[model samples]
Every structure is written in structure tokens, then in C-alpha cells.
Target: MFTLFYVLSLAIACSAVSVDVSDATNRIANGAVAANLQFPYAVSIQRIANNTQVSTRGHRCGGALVTLQHVLTAASCMFEWNADGTRTPITIGNYRVFAGAYLLSNDTATERVRNIAQYVVHPNYLGIPSYVGDLAVVTLSTAFASSTATPLSLPANNYNPADFTDCVVAGWGAATAASQTGANVEQKYANKYIYNQQECTSVYNALQGLPNILPTMVCAVSYDIVSSSCHGDEGNALVCGNTLTGILALHSNCAATSYPEIYTRVSNYTDWVRPIVSLANSFTSGASVLLLLTLIQMTFANLLS
Candidate 1:
């Protein structure tokens, strides 16, 4: 069983990517409060403890709205490994997603909260130290109202990472690298530049001696040291222009001079996402009909057997 404590400890230790590192530059750490509705697709994911419906303090991560009833996030956000190396999946009842929420501490009429009905983690995702395909789709119990939250557009099938030189990342993640606190309730954003894969790999390899940066990942470096996502920013959206191009995956050192933040390339997995989102939308629009049809099919198959 993966307890809340275990996940929290891992979050604190990893700081949303890897173990926290000490850095002295404050200029390189400047994330500013996002403008209201600046990121309409942004959503805050709260992990409940003991199957409770209420949001547990300090159990939150960031995610992006992909469809009315679907969200895109990191697979690690929804699953963890047990003490015996067995995988423990988080229950749908343990999650609540808040859309159009700028400050979680304050209640706003504009905010739309929904319980998770189900989730699908990428089949290729393994675990830490090898976060290859760290992606997941979360299906909400109810669809978000269009007035409350608008889904962000996914990248084109032939979207080139090179064309996205100016990218913006938004989340309710920590404000600074040294702060061991949970994510800030206020939304924050920073501008970053996409880095060449080779250049990104060189920096990580030299700093951590781990060449884990894969082609499936997208890399970006902050224009300034203070403009990067730190711990609690995992699963946040990396938007280029109006499209979601990446999902926060890992980082070597938050706001460090040489290290760059890595994200799961959203473009690489569009093939996988399209089918899931289609099914989710269909299920949402015709729940009773689909359920009846599924039951009838199962009955017929059973009789034939």
C-alpha cells in the first residue's frame, strides 16, 4: 500500500524531478503570479487520503485540461511503487481536480471541481530513475463547464519543437528551490526557451552523471535563473504559443545556471491520447447508453460462451 506519507516524502525529496540541490542565485529563481485566467487550461490536482473527498493539505500537483472530461498529467502523479517493488495505483476516489483555480486557499465561484472517475497511465511508464513515458490521462466524473475552463489545444501531429522557441510554463508549484513547503495556492508562470536535446543531455550528464534524457522528452531552459518550475510543478503544462507542447517531467536543479528542466513531449504521444480522449468524451456524453450497450454485449458474449 502506498500511503500518503510515502508519496509526500517522495515529493519532498524529488522536488518534482530529482533530489533537491543547493544553489545561491536568487535572480535565476523568479516566477511571477499568473494573470487571472491567463492559463485557463491549468488545473490543480489534489490527492485525498483514506478515501476522503476533501482536499488534503499539502497533497497537490499541477495538471492541464485537455478535454471537457479529461486531463493530462504525469503518470508518476497517479501511481507509486510499494516497499516490495510492487506498483500501487492510486484510487479514483483519492483525487479531486480543480479547474479555473488561481488560488486554492480562496473559494471562487469561477472554480470548478470534479472527482476523478478513472485514469489511464501510459503502458511504457516504469518508475523513477527511468521516467521514460511519464504520461497519464485522468477522466473526470463530470465535465467542466465551458465558461469555467477551456481546454488547451494539443500540438499538431507534425509540430516541431524547434518552432517553439518561446514557451511558457504555469503551475501552482513552489516559489523557490529552497522552500520545502507544499505548492503555493496562487498560480505562477515563467518563460523558457527550448533547448537542443544534445545540449540538454550534456548538462545533465555532466551534473548528475545520468544520461536519462531521452528523445521522447522535451527540454527547456529558463531565460533567467529565477524563471523555472521547482518542486510541486510536476505535470504542469508547458505551452508554446496557444498549444500545450510539454508536460513537466523532471529537472536536474531548479533555476540552476547550467541545468535545464525536462518535460514529456506532448507531441510524441498524441497518437496515444487521441483514442483515450475520444472514448472519454463518448462515455461522458452517452453514459447511460454506453453502459447499457456494454452490459448487453457482455451478456450476449457470456451466453455464446
Candidate 2:
């Protein structure tokens, strides 16, 4: 995931006003938010400190409400450690829809922000050693408030990776004009070039200098000029032909061309995902227990009466 300071320092500026989808396609400036994005699938996350208050002002990353109860995001977003070794609280809901000034119709377009009841980072994800296993699932206290809001797309049961030849990556990271933060985070769809492990490792060989890039990671290069994940775009979705197959996680670095943007292969983590989603349902099941208890109490009261 790109850091707030570094991504903000870049010079990729785009206006926040309504932009033509054509201009956004070409990447004339920086990028544009989706014109008629019926379901706002992406969410802007806010981190809060142990004081149980919003602290550590930082960049907003993207995520998907895969189920009514679970959210998928880049593990790096939660790996940040405090002196006490505790992770911060992540805020999710329609409240974040305000990010790109697309709030006029938010009543119908946004996912209601919900607090995470629990979270699970891929056990193998090494916080520092390698950021590759950078996937995590957040179970919200309640299922997201849904309307016409887009739901998370699940990886096809037996989908072929090679089939995803091209895709559009969208986010609201820092714009290029160094000092000016764009009015809202925007989306720009880019033509992506899928990179095989051997190829991507070779391209980014200078950094890791090893052929260790795993098949679990997918790399994509953008045809749109000045288009790439920057600060604040971490954990966004890489929608390939409308089917979201990956969660934006890493790249050589934010705004780097030689290094392709990397994502957490959704298919690779499906097994680990099953259990986390199961736990999310437990919260709802607890409510069922409460209802049962209430019923029993009512019967007892009737007998006493």
C-alpha cells in the first residue's frame, strides 16, 4: 500500500468536477470518477486509535463489502503497529461516500458505514519481510446497509487466471499537483496488461533482485498515461471487464511505471476466506440466541401472570 505523504507529493492532478468518461479513458489529466457508477463498491477507510477516537490522520484505502458481514482489504492497512502493539479501528460505511463529492445521490448509492467486529489477516502475511501475502478480511458488527449499492464480486468457482487479459483499476489517491488535494477521490479506468510471474519478477528485479514474485500475485501495467495506484488507492479493486478479480495491494511503489501494480489474487485466498466469513455470520447468529432468550422469558412471565 502507498503511503499518504509520498503519494500526496506526486504531481498527478485531476479536477474533481464532472469529467467525460472518454477523457478519463485517455488519462488526459490524471483520472475521473466513474460517470454512472450505479453501485459504489469501493469504500474509503479511516483508522482510529486506542483512545477509541479518530487519530493518525492518513490516506484512505479502498475495499469491498464481499458479504453483508465481511470486508476485504490489503493486510498492510492493518499491519501498522502502535507502541502497545495494537491495530487501529477501521471505519466503513456510506459516510465515506463523501470522498469524491458524489454525495448528491448517496442515499441510494452508498454502503452504510459499519464498525468491524473482528478482522483476520492472512496468517502467512509477514508484516515487513515481504508484503506479498497482503490480504485481510474485516467482519463488521452488522451487515452493510445495502440499497442499489454494488455488492462484492466473488471469484468464479473454477475461473482461469489467464482469462483476465485486461481490466480497469479505479481509486481516489492523491492527485499530482503537489500542494492541492483534489476535491474528491476519483476513478480512472486503465487498460491493464496482465503480467506473468516470471515476467513481472524480471521487470521489478531491480528491487527484490530475485525471482520470488509468487503466482498468487497479479501485476498489471496501465495504458492510460499518468495512471497507476498512488497514495490512498491501496486496497482498491482491479475490475477486469466488470468482474472484480483482485484487490489492489502493492506495486513496485506508488506511481512507478517500471514496476507494475500488484494485487492480492482473490482466487488464491478463497480457502482462507471461507472461515472468516463464517465467523461474521456468528454475530448475526448471536442475535438469534437473544431472540430465543426473549421468547423463553416471555413464556415464563405468562406462566407467572
Candidate 3:
């Protein structure tokens, strides 16, 4: 029930980790054209086929460059939705990431094209109700240049997202919720108001008729505008300053109306993520490491997302 700006008064007492408070004004509340260098950490995650990137078609999902050699994104983006409402897991080798591009329509020299050498889905992402622990990290075939594609930092410690006032999400999701083909060719950025844990749960239940909003997640909404996460941008970055804090998890509304956009809180899983990315150092000797990830048990759960 507290306004996000009340954050100023609370900051004096709370031991919460802080980020840039002025970011909200600099980033728009609704969708707007992103300058070429505005968000250098954002990358277009595309599907590759026949060893060629499907770039002419818009990106498959948006992802954040969490490390010079790894990307932080939703685990669900690793699938291809079938007509029968089932998702087929795509091969990790078929994934390609293009960084430092403003528009997908134009081929820019700034693009750092790298194929995914490997990806590790979170051990808890079992496709049950489907949103639990929906996170993944992909190692790039080669590290990107530090100047062109900057990696956003994970919180130095257990960070409270509510401590910061401005949080922005930028992606190439659809302009309108219902338009499948009218997807964003140009990357767009928007400001979203973060809600407290209680309001996040209540607002989701009231607005989307959603039965559950887990503790592992955070919710935000563009209250003054119709902006919300839509089709094609499930793994976009939700950033507050240089910190990459959320990954777009569910954009359940597809009717040109806004609902509480769900994001997987990065702070909650920082411990699990850091090790996965740091392990990339093994690739230094030019030797392939077989990643033995713990398989999530899905035997008793519904597989449809």
C-alpha cells in the first residue's frame, strides 16, 4: 500500500542494498525507441537453424549479458512451442546471441555474434505449474568485447528490489499483446513501478485471476500506461541501474491490456547463478566440459506450460 517514492524515507533506516534512484526518470514508463547505446547490456537471443541465424525474423526472446561469457535468461526460452500445446526442447547448439544492436532489421557491425557453447537450466525448473525457478545461464562460444556489450552485475549481496525507485525493462516483445506478427523489430524500453511482496501477490490474484504468485518471484506494472511484457520477450532484462535484477517470467495477458508482469527475482537466486557462470573459466584451456546438470524430476507433474 506504500508508494515507491516512500522509499526515500525508508532508505534512511533500512539496511537494504541500493541502486540509482534517478533511473526511473531517464527510462520511460511506456514503450519508447531505445538509442543504439542506451542499453548495451541487452542482447537479442535468436534461434539458429542450418547453422545460420534467424535474424530477419525478430529475436526469439530478450536476454541480459550477465557476464562477458554468459547470459542470464528464462529457462522456458529453451523450448519450441508445438501445436499440441507441448514444448519441445531446442538444442543448445541451435541458440545464438546478438549483442549491441538497436534494430533487428539492420545488420550492424557492433553486433557480437556468439553461439551458445552450453546452457544450464535451473535444477528446480520442472515445468510443474511451470513458473518455479524459471532461470538459466548460457555460456557463449567466445567472450564478447567489454566495451561494446557490458555485463550487468548481480547484487553484491541479498538485495531488496523495493529499496530502489526506478526499474526499467527493455525488450523486443510485441507492441500490442494480441499481435503475433506485429512484434517489436526495434528494441523498446519502459519504466515499471515495483510492488511490495504483499501487493505483488494480491494484485496478481485480483487482476489476472491467477491462483498463485510464488515468493521466488517479484511483480511490477506500468500503472499509468498500457505497457506490459507481451509475446516474444519472456527472458528480457528488468534492470535498476547497472544491476540486472529480474528476468521476464510470465506475460500472461495477451489481450492488449496490462496485468502485473511477473519477473523472477535475481536477488533470490544470486547464490545459485554465480557458480554456474564462474564455472565458465574451465573453457579457458580450449577443452569442452561436459556439464552434468541435475535433471528436474517431472514424472508426476503436468508438462504443458
Candidate 4:
């Protein structure tokens, strides 16, 4: 019975995809939170191009709306190509800014109003051979509404890595039975920050034989075997204690055994994130000035008319 159980665990971990649990559910790991939980900004995304649209059935990832316009997410979730190898366009926005659900599993999420003004992926993101450290930003069509629960929270300027010694990961991902391909199902799991780069290198190699975990990433594991976030959970936020710390970039093949999920450390990439944010701010200021001038011109024209 012991040998059979071990083999079954490894097999489930090696499965390439994950499906959401509808009938039975496991006790979610790291599911604890403070009495009054503060919510981070959530952004919904879609893939499209000039004249074509892509499927959005499982098109949800947690994000932070840094400025009035910019929404940040893991680049791994957005990077894709067609048969011709052309870049695919991505659409991103706050809950009401676009038409989608926040928790995603919640019904009655069909309220599409605002459109995306621009979408920007980190140019430095390296995909294959190095599946870690993928991050990006999206500019929305307008400022988010202040009255909503989707307001952006500031990233901890100097995040204490120790704070995340044990953190929580929330997403609309499969509870178990690896293979993150299915209808959106929101779930949350608590995971302990197992170790840093040094340990991750050893753990990943021993488990999956991968190398160079990279300074831009961190590793996390759920002590509970049946409790975890899977594939579609990519790009979701890893809440360290109470502060939003990093973005869930990828896991070791869905739910590979003893292998922890890797995330793009937002704090580590602060240098890289600054420039992208600056560009968005500059664009916003320029547009604000342009709008002021246009309003003045329209007023003069109306006086003349």
C-alpha cells in the first residue's frame, strides 16, 4: 500500500495539465489570512490581434494595477505565437474596465465597458531554456473607478523575503488531478516559502534536472499533497503574509512531486519594473496635457459657434 501510494503521487505530479475539482476537494494548504484581508488589484486578460479573436475560457490571472493605467502580470501567461511565428496581441484591464469576473467562478461577470489602451510585455523576458522571470504591463483605456474593490495596492518598496516564509496563493486553478486545462474555478492554497535560490537549484535539479533558478525567481511548496494551485494559476499573485510579493510564473510541470512552484519576484525585478512604469506614467502625463489643450480649444470653438 505504501509503495502504491508513492507511485500514484509521482504520477499525479508528472501529469502535464490540471483540472478543477467539482465533486470532491482537498483541504487547501496555506489557506490562512488575517482577520481583515486587504485585496490586491485584479486584472483580466484576453488574446487577440488585428482582426481575429482567441478563446478566453481560462483567461484569468491575478494582477496589480500599479498606476491609474498600468496593470502588471507574468509575461509567461501572455507570450505566444501563431503558425507564422508572429507575436500575439493581449487585451488587459481592471474588472469594470473590461467585461469579466474578478474571482472568475462568480456568475454574472458579463459587463464589458472599457477597452485596453495599450499592452506591453517585458522585452527582457526569456521564455524557453529559462522558464522563469516573465513579467509585463498593460495600459488601460481609462482610470479605474475609485468605488470598486479592484483598487491597486502598492508593492512593498523593500519586501522582506522572510515575511513570505509561509504565504498564500489564491487563483482560479485546479485543486488537484493535474492538468490546468478546464473551465475557470477560483481557489486558494497556502504554501510555505521552502527555500531561496541555492535550495531551489538543488531541489529543481534533484526533482526535474533544471538549472539556473535565477535571482528573478523564488520557490514555494505546499506541505499538503492534495492541496495546490496548478497550470492556469500562472501569473497569479503570491501574497506574502499580507503584502503582495511576487507573481506566480510557473510550476514544475503542473504538480510535479517535491518540486515547488516558481514565481517572478516582483521585489527582485524592481529595477526592471521601474522603467516600464515610468514610460506608462510619462504617457499618462502627456495625454493629460493633450486633453487639457483639446478642451480649451473646444471651448473657444463653441464660443465662436
Candidate 5:
């Protein structure tokens, strides 16, 4: 975690906004408080420290449940790349996912907590300072039985982010640019629109050390761009219509206008994610052969993308 200082510093420099890298759980910037069960797929990925269930302090990243056992999030949530271009992964046991949790304190009856069994960061993920291939699929220690939490629907094979409309981003990121301190207990969400890819690229590229936006990444913003997603929202889902089309890779200054947020397009990685969720769900269905064939098909689609 100490090595992340360099990466966090780089991000701060690029945004020209003060960012407190200490606690990961934060409030949404100028967004509405979400109704309970409204986003049953929203999950809080918190690093275990102190008595967690009711405690209000810890590092956390936002994520969505893609399956009872698998979660889709950003690689930046699980690993950190060093200045030397090497890497370090957070211990699997250090963090846990809380699904069906709208409020941070006392919602255990509705919340399903799970320890992470393992995770798969995209093979091409370059970690922070680079948002390319930022997605990761995390497997839970055990699958949840019928619960209040629901798995978010993944994008279609032909899902095009350019066609994305009526999207929403939900998280516990800070509400103001001035706050890099304190704790936020409830989840919040904001309506967003797909921002122009080329335009977004130009804006960030102007920042000296930032990486170029790739085709695999999608950009989004509020109607007025001033109210946007913030730092601690990393790894949360960007749902458009009824499908999960984006996984937040890097957030913009929530208090700044015109700078849009970026996410790794879920459509670009559907091929990689499909098999994991499908195979796990099909193991007891006696359809291994058909599943293998479908996996091969998705592989081709990903290659073409």
C-alpha cells in the first residue's frame, strides 16, 4: 500500500485536485441517496479493519455482483503497480464484499458478506496511471443463497457503449472536492450520459503523465459535468438501461465541471467474464460441452473487439 503513494500522487497531479488516499469508502458527489434495494447489485468492498459490520472506518472500493460468486470491478481495486512497473496484490483475506448493503451500519439481515476466494485482473491491466483493461472478476469464498442482493446483468455480446443512454453510477465516493477525510455510511447514485470518447481522451492526454484513453475504456458525465463521480468510487458499475455496461476505472473531480469520468467497457471484456460466471453456474447443470463451445465463441468476439 505504501508504494501506491507514487501512483496516487500521479493521479492527483493529473487532476490538479487534492485527493486523500487514506480511506476508500466515501460519499457520492451531488447525487441522490439511493432507495433500499434499488441497486441490489451494488456492493461495498471494504478492507477489514476494526469491527467492520457496524464500524465506519476502513479502505473500500465499490463493485457490483456479476454472479453470486463473482464480482466485476477495476484492477486498481485489487493491485497496485510500482514506479518500476512491477506489482503488488492486496491479500485476499484483507477485504470482504457486502452485497445488498445500502447503509454502512446494521443491515446484516439484508447484507450478504463474503470473503474473497480469488480474483482475476485482466491480463492487460497496467494498473493505476493507466485505465486500459482495468476490469477484474472476483470470486467469493462461497456463493450466496437466495438473498436480498441480486447479481447485476452483464452487457449483451453486441452491447455498444456508444449507444449507451440512461445510465447511472452508484457508490460511496466523497460528495465534495474538499473532503478526503471522514466516513460516509450510505450508498448514492447519479444519472449520467456517455461522454465523447475522443474528446475525453484529449482532455486527459493533456495531463503530462496520464495514459491515453483506449478503445476498451468508456467515458461518462452528469448532465452538467460539474457533478461527477469521485476518487473512492473506483471499481463500481456503470449501469445503462438494464445492463452493466461499464466498470469505473478512474473517477474525475466531482466538484469540477467538464471533466468526465472513465470506465472499462464491460462489452469489451464480456468474452473474458462470460465463461467464468457461466461455467461456475453450469457445473451442476450437466452442460459442460455446450458451455465450452459458447466460451470459444466469446473468445473470438473479444479478439475482434
Candidate 6:
């Protein structure tokens, strides 16, 4: 089982404000501060030093809460590539998840912090240059209280990507490509339009010399060049009408003038995800059984004494 920890005195003072969803959708460039409770399913995957206090630093990636105890993200976020082009899984000790976090600088009392119990990456995923099957499920040590946050639903098997044009991507990643120094303290979000896969493939192949966009990937472009997901946004969610549609994969260049961003098509892998989620629940069930057995053993010992 994983252990939970807390970071104290990090909350900042900020007034909650309201935003019009339509206006937000039409806006262009650099994204905007997300409204409080705007994205209850968004989560921050943070990396902390061993034996150190939790700080605002070390945010590794972003993800979406897909179940009470599971977060969906890119498999690349959980592994490191070596000089020899081989990959190694990252240790669980270096990470934690913060759910219902609107502002990292101002973590509210309701936000939930959880340690990762275990994670499963797609079997076909290899490192860079070929990010096919780039998805993973992060199981939390403990489930989040229902009152604290609700999990986002995955797209149905019959769901068609072309039917949804307006979409939103949210994360604590760099707000702009020009400023990649630090991630936003508060969650930032922007609107993007799903683009034709052929057009997206043409752009990437011509510019970056990369392979054609795979069937397992989806492409989206910002209304303009200035607003797009950048560094630190990896593994974030591409949500359409509250349904998780994709996982952030790659972009030609952060806020590029021509290239569109690529995401792992979640709709294409519902079969792979559903079973892993069921497996995650078994971990919780096993933990409960162990606890009960320990309690009963203690009770019998006391009776003999």
C-alpha cells in the first residue's frame, strides 16, 4: 500500500470569480486562469524528493481522474528514456497526485492528495520517435471522497471524434511557449478545435519529418497560434463536453504557428482501460481483506490472554 502526505502553508489568497463558458470558448492566445471547480477531474502529477517536505516544485505531468482511484495519463510520464534508447519505469516513491486542484499556489481545504499505489502502461508503448499506445493508468493509494471530486467519464465505444468540434484542454503547464521556465501555479485552460487527421498528418510530416499520425492519436489546433498546450502539459486531459476524449501526447512546437497538437485517442482504447480500472479496485479489496485479518488475529490474541 502507498502512504499519503501533505504540504502545509502553500495556499495563497485569491477571490473566486465566474466565467462565461461561451466567452471562454471564443477567446484566443495564452489561455486563461480556470474558474474554481471548473475542472474537478483534472489532476497534477507531482514529483517530490525523497524524505523531503512537499513543495510547489517538481510537477512532472498532468492527468484526468477517470475513476474513484485511477488517473489517466501518458505512459511517457511514468518512464524515463536512457542514452541507449531503452526505457525504465519510474519508481513510485517520487510521485503524488493532487486532485481538484484549481490553483497549485492556493490549495483549498477540499483538494485531495494521494500517493500512487501502482501504475500500468500500455504494452505497445515504446519511447520517443514513436509514441504509439501512449497511455497509462495511475492507481491511487486511497480513493478520493465523493464529496471532494467526481471522476470524469470516458467516451463511449460508438462515440465519433468528428461530432465534437469544441474542446478544452486543462493543466498547470507552461502558459506560453515563450515562457517555459516555470509552470502556472493556477490551472490554465484553453479552447481548441478538432482538426482533420489528414491535415494534421501533413503538417507534422512536412515540418518535423515525423511519421503519420496514428489511428490511436487525435489532433487538435488552437483557434490561433498563441494558445496551445506546451511543456509540462504532458499527460493532461483533452475534454469535450465533460467526457475525456484524449491524453496529451505531443506538439510540433509549443504554440507553433502551423503544427497542431497530438493526443492519444482515448475512445480507441476503452477496452484496454476498462479492465485495468477493474484491476485497480481489486487492490483496494485486497487491502481491506488484509486489514480485517489483522484485526481478527488481534482479537483472538486478546481472548487467549
Best by lDDT: 5
| Predicted structure 5: clash tally | 4
- Pairs clashing in candidate 2? 11-176, 12-176, 13-176, 92-113, 93-112, 93-113, 94-113
Question: In what order do the candidates fall by TM-score, top score first?
Answer: 1, 5, 6, 3, 2, 4
Give the better candidate number (5 or 6) by TM-score.
5
> Candidate 4 lDDT (Cα, whole model)?
0.53
In order, what lDDT does every prediction score?
0.70, 0.54, 0.65, 0.53, 0.73, 0.69
Clashing pairs in 5: 26-172, 26-173, 27-173, 27-174
Model 2 gets an lDDT of 0.54
TM-score of each: 0.79, 0.68, 0.76, 0.67, 0.79, 0.78
Candidate 3, residues 70-113, lDDT tens digits: the string is 88988877766554456677676775888876776543453467
Residues 121-177, candidate 4: write the lDDT tens digits.
677776543655578776666665554435445455566476228766655444444
Q: List candidate 5 stretches off by more than 4 Å.
A: 1-13, 16-22, 50-59, 80-87, 107-111, 177-184, 282-305
lDDT per residue for candidate 1 within 1-305, as digits (tens), equals: 22333233333434434432111112113577777788889887776446442333443567899997899998877864455545678777766787876766543343478888888999998767677898999998888899888998777767766833999888776556665554335677888888788765654554342437787888887776546666567788888867788998775345444346779999999999999999777667466668879999999999999
- Native-to-model Cα distance after best TM-score fit, residue 72 in candidate 6, in Å: 0.4
Predicted candidate 6 versus true structure: per-residue lDDT over 1-305, tens digit per residue: 01111001001100110111101111113777788768888887877546552432456788899997999998888875465556678788777788765766544343478889889999988657667898999999899888777888878866656833888988776544344233336778878778788766655554332445887889886765567665667788988767788998774234334346789999988889998898667647566868878999999999999
User: Where is model 3 more than 4 Å wrong at Cα?
Assistant: 1-30, 49-57, 107-111, 178-184, 205-211, 252-258, 284-305
> Model 3: how large is the Cα RMSD against the reference?
12.1
Best by TM-score: 1
Q: Per-residue error at 67 for model 5, in Å?
A: 1.0
Q: Provide the lowest-lDDT 10-residue window in model 3.
A: 17-26
> Which 10-residue window in model 6 sums to the lowest lDDT?
5-14
- Answer with 2 or 6, whichever has the higher TM-score: 6
TM-score of 1: 0.79
lDDT of 5 by residue, 1-305 (tens): 43244334335534643233234556777788888778988877776665543353453678888887789988887864355555688778777887766776643552367788778888998765676788888888777665657887778767875643779988887776566565536778888888778766766665665767888888887775555677678888999887898988777656545456778999889988998777666562336567878999999999999
